[model samples]
Target chain A: MNHPPTTATLLALLATLACNVDRKQDDVPATDPPTPHVALLTSGPVSDAGWHAGAYEGLQLIGDSLGFEVSHQQTRTPAEFDEAFISYAEDGYGLIFGHGFEYQDAASRAGEQYPDVTFVVSGGSRPSANVVPLLFHLNEASYLAGMAAGAVTAAGIVGMVGGVEIPTAKGTFVAFEAGVKAVRADAAVLETFTGDWYDPSAAKEAAAAQLRQGADVLIHNLDAASFGFFQAVREAREGGSEAWAFGMNRDQNDVAPDVIVGSAVINIPAMFLRTATAWRDGTLGGVAEYAGLRVGAVEFVPNPAQEGVIPPEALARIDEARQAIIAGELEVPRIEYLEPEDDDPPSP
Target chain B: MNRTLTPVLTATAALAATLAVAAALLALGGHSPGAVFAALLRGAFGTWDRFFSFTLVRATPLLLTGLAVALAFKARVWNIGAEGQLHAGALAGVAVAILLPVHSPLLVLPATLAAAAAAGALWAAVPAAMKTRMGVGEVITTLLMNFVAVFLAQFLVQGPLQEPRGVFNQTDEIPLAARLPALLPDTRLHLGFLLGIVIAVALWLYLTRTPGGFRLRAVGASPRAAEVSGRFRAGPVVWLAFLTSGAIAGLAGWIQVAGVTHRMYEGLSPGWGYTAIAVALLARLNPLAVVVTAIVFGALSAGGGAMQREAGVPEVWVRGIEALVILAVLTVDRSWQVLAGGGSRD
Candidate 1:
């Protein structure tokens, strides 16, 4: 913006350098804006307004506070993953957050290729020499959400709907079921995989199926599908039945204001800043590290506006479970599928 | 000179005007339109490899779908179900690849390809039959069938065809034996590109030289006049045209799956069917011309991401440029039609 007239002026300079004789028409290098050189490549756009939004918000926060240049490239396929990384690296970007688990393989190759730059993948497994997997131990929060869901279910029947069955995604569900069992011995917990990250319709169908089977409380481990789960409970309550819903990934009680009881909140921006600062300090890579309950990175946020919906005894149990997990007494279930560990032994 | 320059100049002016409007919109929104354009060009053609890679990758499906639309349009038959037909082809190709026990690429490749083409032909035949026998609109029937094709792919991926271990809504990767060999070492361009070229050349010869193709063109020009001549049956020619067009588009989808993604996911197409309509029309339904047009569009899409990455433009704005290009072409077509119609009327 400060250099619009300088574009035409640069054309004049290029002409002057060519020699004073025949005035020639050069292909005008006059088409684009002068932008600083920092870029990030992601597998999907944040326009999705849900799972990807919190990550985008963290990126924006970095832009505002850190005074660093920022740009995002949305890729559609796994094939483009490496290409996007190479593109950002070749363009001389300082830091890049790959924003998804799919970027692990590409980030490894990129880390080796562009050793000068730092690369981060949101839920990646093995951090190469230059790449770091900023693993958010949301299962700590998920365990708390399960306590809430378990406490509210009078029928002893609660349901969990998950969006892709990846290990990181599955960890939340595994921990949630564990938390439910700890609270109540004879509870019936049904889990379903809608098999999509953004299918609201499928999520709604899974919610309805759970509801029909007499599930009064529901928790969703979905990205965009949480809307459908919340809608199912809201619709149920409208039809004169008492129903409660819980959220995942980010604090999503705001999504369905009246219907949501609480959300398992993960402070992505805190993790992002910590990871970036660690990378700057030369202490970021090697081994898959995690930020759990200790760093206040992951926690459950109950809707303060609606306190009576979740029984006080249940909240107390949730608090107890949270304390137990933080104190290292409860080993939250997680899918260990990724490595620099040569063997990918089958999970039970 | 008059004929060539007239159309070219008309196209260029129309494109420039639409791009100007698009730029103004971007600028008014407080974004750098110039940066977006530069990033697009740099992303698409910044280097020799990038240009060729974008052109080749984008051209693969466009080549097949362009041929499909051109073939049917030549016979004056509207087969608007290439999208659906393509999915049907992918469904068969994926099924055959996953089910077949054969190890060698030589055997599995041809079998899967044949299955895909046959499935596409079968999908197209339903609408072709309706149009020929029941006097139904092929456009509506083909359009309606796309949902069935899309949802059928979804259902199979989620239910019976699902990879039992993974709970994601995606199919198992096709066997390595069914995959196409890459055309280039670094780029994703595959054997389908060469095949697309060969098919385009064959179509060009058939449309211009062969008696059957001439009759189809005659029908397209004036179906009533072709009937009055009493030399050929428009019904069978139209039916065959529709089915074959669908089969080619289906082949396109199958190749995209095996050659590129290696797995099937929903939204496999970012509206490749509709993109084929533009590809066919821009070349004036000429098979040879379609090659160039498809590459241009491929550049636009392939370059769009670069705009987002390097230039800081949003995906929506990158898509706006594509819409502008299409609108420019359409406006040119409409003006040409109006001018020609007006002159003939006079």
Candidate 2:
């Protein structure tokens, strides 16, 4: 019958909690060998299983291998970007990884302010003395996947379903087209962008439209929505047509073992570890870091379930092209518009 | 109890309850509740720069949208489409900035804002018409219209309104003329925040001073009573409230674009419209109190980043606190109503 007592108890608890916040506590240092602290900023949840997830895994790997204290935050808006960078830098984090191109400008601003802290932006275009872009050459692997698709398809037509028509996305499709034509000279290429990154229904509809246009093989540059592309191909196969799908970003071959031919993967965790180690060694930042087939960062992972689906001759060509790219004899087509450090003088 | 003091006491109680619950939850998750709160405070208001640049910057959109929702709810017009109307306003404002030849701030700013307001009113017209003419619930209609607005924005950014080079899935930045000047000399605090405060004051006066405002409140209190006793039709008042609410929400969108982001993109809003409901209800739908309530929510959002960086507290925990605040406020408000004889029958 006495509500006042409950309210009074709550107020007393809050007063104690407030006092506790002001009391100084012993610092429990979490690093050994006095390693610099590292952190990561992502725009989406790490459980996304694709872009954000890969970056999260990379942050964990860096922490484990380098013995650096690491933390991560999922930022929501551009307004939050600067605050996150400033917080990390001010808190003595020596290295911060922003896992998207969107972080380029904020990273640049933070890099200028915090000269001692290194900022690495994945899929970023701009570079600076303290800000580095981790150029993910997934397009190179996508081209190889295109070669595999060209060899596997019997109808001499291929399709690509993309989340958005950003330059980086279009670059993959462009390279994919060139690779397909390299294998099957007369093959037709159809491209559709769903304009959505996570909508399965829209991706499926776009994929189905491509299938109706005589494209028997489809590759999607979508992240979590690739399942819809695979589903469309599966439905087409159920309706008495032969259709296949290729995965991009992380290895998603097992997502639909029967329909997915292969995956174009960027070994994000390995790349993070290598970059963090390089930073510790004073060899990272001050320029863009390029990771491609040469560095074993990107690869066209063949699905064992789809073995023999792609002709061995096409696989041989893909392997030769991969080696050629590594040996500096072949160059993959890429869109390079995100240069945040372009204004700076070229570093040796 | 003094009537004017009741809402303040209720809000304070609700806030205390939320903090207690949040503290318990943080402790359960193996984090120091005190440390998390300290980090949040430092992040939101530790320094003057942090308070003005971070917390107030985040509060700008919330203030406008909160006032918009509070105004609409005052007349009992359930407008859940503020999100959609915001997008409509932003899209129209950005379109004018990109397509129009106006180059001076004097010319471009007003033109763009006008276009935004008109577009927002247009977006609300559909739902308002449905409610007025066809007797459809504005709740369902407004909510569904949000989907249309979101999709339209996505389509435009990806296709026609995409950056001139067609490289990114965003519109070109608004011209300098159309952009809002900074209210502070060296901070991100823009003129839009001042505009929001001015609008809130104006809305308070309009609601308290005008005969039209009295009629709107009467219609909201009892449509039959207003129509018979006040000798005025409730339908026109409802329509007026709905349109005005959409216009205010529209201004929020364009202000965000012109003030902060500088361009429209897919994730332009982090659900500020939806969050504004909690803000409005917490203020008890008072336009003047909405400013303070919006800042409280803004501090939470701005501090969430600091929690992750300084205390290693996850964003999910901050989100849990936000949800708990909304729940606690609703409960406290409901308890007051019950104590006031509304729930005595039960």
lDDT of 2 by residue, A242-325 (tens): 888888888998889988889988899999998999999999977899888889899999999989888888889999998998
Provide the TM-score, chain A, model 2.
0.93
Q: lDDT tens string, model 2, B288-338?
A: 788888888888788777788778787777787878888998897787676
Q: Which pairs clash in model 2?
A: A125-A338, A125-A339, A126-A338, A126-A339, A126-A340, A127-A341
True-structure lDDT of candidate 2: 0.84
Worst 10 residues of 2 chain B by lDDT: B1-10
Docking class of 1: acceptable
Error of 1 at B82 (Å): 2.0
| Candidate 1 C-alpha error for residue A219, in Å | 2.2
Clash counts for all predictions: 5, 6
* TM-score, every prediction: 0.85, 0.91
Kept native contacts, fraction for each prediction: 0.28, 0.62
Model 1 per-residue lDDT at A220: 88
Off by over 4 Å in 2: A1-9, A24-34, A112-116, A234-242, A339-348, B1-5, B100-103, B343-346
